[model samples]
Target: MALKAAAALDVELMSTGAFSIDQLMELAGLSVSQAVYRVHPPSAGRRILVACGPGNNGGDGLVAARHLSQYGYEPTVYYPKHNKNELYQRLSKQLEDLNVPFVNDFSKALADTDHVVDAVFGFSFSGEIREPFPAVIKALEETEIPVTSVDAPSSWSIEGGPPMSGVGSNFHPAVLVSLTAPKPLVKHFKGRHFIGGRFVAPSIAAKYDFEVPRYEGVDQVVEVMPGGKALVR
Candidate 1:
């Protein structure tokens, strides 16, 4: 219903609001970068390999790479599918402009990184894992590095928790950044879970019963503590 509610809000905004998906992508990426920085502050020359897909989730990764670069974390992007989306291209260009390298070799990327931001898939992923991604997800699972997944961990159900087989057996991420609000999968997570995207209009939020965590201080991402104490305003 989050997608439908967003569509409805887009109509309500008409031309009066910044309803573009790219604008929301920027915010999403910003939130992910901020959360990653806060959760695992980069050390001198610490590297983060952001595994991005071809969709908006990848755009989020590209955007996060840009911000992570600005924050002094050496972030490399491993975008397998470009998909040629204009917004995604623009976001990727922004990252390249910041000197973030797009490394194609997943094995090399995973080996060299201290952390991984799993933006390879979001809430809509289903079915058995495919070609390169199955291998990529496998690499992510095998690596001992901590991973901070954006939206939801890859290879998991959008409506529920982890997948029943394959890499999911070892796909426990260290941190999860749930845009807008935490998903039902949050209940199965034991690590630090954060809620981002606080710009949703009150009417939209109320209509969907989207209870979001209030961002603390100047941070745009707020940690959703256990017991569902998600500090909603």
Candidate 2:
């Protein structure tokens, strides 16, 4: 259900012309930053390591790193597969304008940052883990630093959680921000969960028969997991 719903929602979102890729990524990234702040604020520690891939999910991470930097948090981006697309180039330029450092050593970045935002993968991810990312995911799994994954954790399936053993088995993020809606794999998640996409139209949601949790006041994100920690601001 989650995999199908996610795929359908993507199609609907793109086909309706209601939102552009930039708009969607901005909103999603903003929500991801907010979720990270709620779970691990700058006061905890200022340094943030945003691990990114080469897809839209990586774009979300790049945007989040910029927002986090504006919020007084020092963010470093670790993007292995640098995208050449104009959209991603723009995102990279934005981060570069902020003077945010982009690193190549995942282990070093992981050891240096206070928190990690796992935006290496999303709902559309499939098949076995590829180069660079397997090492990145392994580093994430071994790290003690708290992680906040954007949409879905890296290497996790949209329907199933982490694998029973091996690489992704212990790669649980401390906080998760579900974009558009919570996927079925979320049921297996054991930590704080928040819904991030605020642009989902009521008609579309109804059409899909999925509930978008009510956000508080003007907040872009809403906590869905019971007994979750309070929002920072």
Candidate 3:
């Protein structure tokens, strides 16, 4: 999806009054956590690091980390700049209640964790890599550990995909779980991909002229083939 279209769709969905930010975040985060579990199960390694920013994307990370813990994974959150929004506070509190640890050492996290969840940025992000994140993205680019990014890869443009060179250039996420629908930047990604956000109404999809993946049963997401087909089995 184009950047504008994606933003507009979010607005339209909220206007319908059938959904709230909390509901959407929970579903999207669950889908993200499910994707992580599917690709890198707890049997592989239980210590997962979730890197969260200060936006809605970070909220998704918080929610995903919570679900990961419920699924029996030892998940840690790396939240540098926290969002003060009530929704985000509640999400963080849920993790605290679960006894999940929050860390500030990105270097130690990179060395200690098995997998990383890149929820530091979303489709709305633009411009050069900012403070705190430069070190985070740099560490990620240099790490051998696999990553599962939620929505958009951190520091990537919604239209241009990953940067050609510099901080985010060499950082390739092993898995990407796009919410609502795959954005235009996905065309440049060559990895395991999945689409979450099953809340898109049929009329909204038709109005936007995009196809929603046929989610099986009560599944929250479906794998998207490189050719853009949903692997619905």
Q: Best lDDT goes to which candidate?
A: 3
lDDT of 3 at 228: 83
lDDT of each residue in 66-155, candidate 1, tens digit only: 999998889998998886867777787888788889888999888888889999988766676777898988887777888999988888
Candidate 3 collision pairs: none
Off by over 4 Å in 3: none
> Estimated TM-score per prediction?
0.89, 0.94, 0.97
lDDT string, candidate 2, 1-233, tens digits: 37877888888987873788888999999999998888887789999999999999999999999999999999999998999999999999999999999999989888888999999999789888898999999988888899999888998888888978877888888988989888888878988889886888888888888776667888899887543343453
Clash number for candidate 1: 0
lDDT of each: 0.79, 0.88, 0.90
Worst 10 residues of 1 by lDDT: 1-10
lDDT of 2: 0.88
TM-score, prediction 1: 0.89
Backbone clashes, each candidate: 0, 0, 0
Least well predicted 10-residue stretch by lDDT in candidate 3: 11-20
